[model samples]
Target: MRFLCILVVLFVGLKAFSQDSVSVPSIDTTQHTKDTLTIIGVGDIMMGTNFPEDKLPPNDGDFLLKDVESVLKSADVTFGNLEGTLLDSGGIPKKCNDPKVCYAFRTPARYVKNLINAGFDMMSLANNHAGDMGDEGRKSSMATLESAGIVHAGQMSQKTAIFEKEGIRYGLAAFAPNSNCVPLNDLQGAVQIVKELADTCDIVIVSFHGGAEGAQYQNVPRTNEIFHGENRGDVYKFSHTLIDAGADIIFGHGPHVTRAVEVYNNRFIAYSLGNFCTYRGISVNGVNGLAPIIKVFTDKQGNFFKAEITPTYQTYATGVRIDMQKQVIKKIQELTKKDFPESKTQIDDNGLITYLAQ
Candidate 1:
């Protein structure tokens, strides 16, 4: 009897201990795993010109982005500066007194599908060309992008575009010196908008189409740049201020050439991506031809982890093609070194980017 009672007590004690162990919460390692996201950005993209049929590309815009489509698709978000309006027809063109200097770009509304196929999730409509055809053109462009489910921002009235992917919310705001878009000169206003976006979303991306134009403008000037008597924003000041205002990434374009990449306060900034795919009415020579697609990886809170630059080139009347020599990466490296000698970001010959220990 005594032996049987002892066995029962031992079994009861073991059972209680097993229940207690099971009731204790197990460490949830899954919740602690790092969450990351990838964002890719490119510069000006005008698939084809619609003002004159002859200006359009050969394949009805079919092959415009074929070469870089897959690379663009491989990101959580792909963005570009939609340098022109999307209108099928019927809008009065902007009056330009100088026929030699004035150029306008209008892409057919049907070509929006090509952008979708290219895997573009967002765009900036703040370039000088956005108003080439007036408010009607801008309205048509906005409608077309909306129908295609692509998020866009840059208009003065609509300064921010918020989107969500994979349960993460992202906010984007674009600034430019042109009319009908968020003014790049209003630094205080721009910072306020960015701060509001940062408060509302998990990540905030600030884009600006500022700085001088052409190959001579390859270097980032610390002061306000003036091209053709227009005051392009002080890009160095603008980018750093936006980062201070809580922007995770800053993508700058409008200078028709690639510029330096800097890490300011642990955020990534590409001063200029150059002309990615401008089919007509744009120069594509020397440094102007260099196109870069920058891919950035960041943690859930938008801390930069690493980056990669896939160099591309665009010749006259041709779309963007991958550069085997990685010329754009090399150019960026040189400019980064010259413009920001104390930068923590490192760019290798192979286009890989890393940060040094603080």
Candidate 2:
């Protein structure tokens, strides 16, 4: 009887092992169609009245961005901060700190071709510089952006823009911390609007101009900034909250320097991209241009699976030429390495930081 019981137990054990050894079929995740969406974003583009001589020919005032045409065209979508109005009228009222060098920018309506030629699909008009020319200037900016077929968001109409590509829908929203610019008080409403768009679209990208200026590098979260004695923005908590409400990518500016990069819930957030093509006389503020061209891949269901980053630099002077820089790649990696821990990035010959998602 004992021999019979032992035989039965051994037989059951063998059956269990056999069942465990049987292989289960793996799901073909790669079978679904995949597409790579490359998004190139830049910092402040102060292409205004700094040049007294280049008052733009009547038909082509937007010619300032002619030099970087090839570079801009390489990307699928290009975005930047339109620092001034593009209208032909509206004279300057309040003078800048320097009179001989006081800055007020306006361009002919036709120069938008330069931006289109530079591969710009969209821009953010919610900046301090946008209203520099007053209500008329701001109105002119809106009209110019529309005329150029370039989509913009900020203190303008339709806070959220719905853009479709490759059969995928994307929502873009721009915000700031003040009414004069992108008032911080409007954040809750903006979040709600963006969240609604996220629900209906595959991805949502939010751009903001905030944080203090100068050589300061540390992220002073929760603290609001008062630029020129006027409230500018509240970046820290506002950004994280936006992520919670459903923002896939968040690009920040106004710091005039690269702040930091973090991955939250598989989404990418760049605290500050620094100066892109700000030809303002300030040298230090325009040094290492760290605008990143981010490429993202999402499933049909809008689930972001991977991304890459490319870094570029701009020389701030008469010739606002942008050059690809290698150190910028190392800087971003080193900055994000501690937070991501497994963050890995490589710089290509063209000075693009290709970050591998962990």
Which candidate's TM-score is highest?
1
- Please give, for residues 1-358, the per-residue lDDT of candidate 1 as tens digits: 2233235335554222131011101111122233888999999988788784557777677787888999999998899999888998878788776767678888888889889999998889888989888888898997798678787788865567766565566778999998888899999999998998787667788899999998888898899998777899899999999999999999999998999999888899999999998887788878888889999999978899999999999875457899999999899999999999988889999899888858
TM-scores for every candidate against the unseen true structure: 0.89, 0.73
Q: Considering summed lDDT, which 10 consecutive residues are worst modelled in model 1?
A: 19-28
Global CA lDDT of candidate 2, please?
0.59
- For model 1, the local distance difference test gives 0.83
Quantify all predictions' global Cα lDDT against the true fold: 0.83, 0.59
Tens digits of lDDT, candidate 2, 224-282: 77655656567767777888888877788877776666655566677777776554443
Candidate 1 residue 259 Cα shift, in angstroms, is: 0.4
Q: What TM-score should be assigned to candidate 1?
A: 0.89
Q: RMSD in angstroms, all models?
A: 13.7, 16.1
Q: Residue 209 of model 2: what lDDT?
A: 83
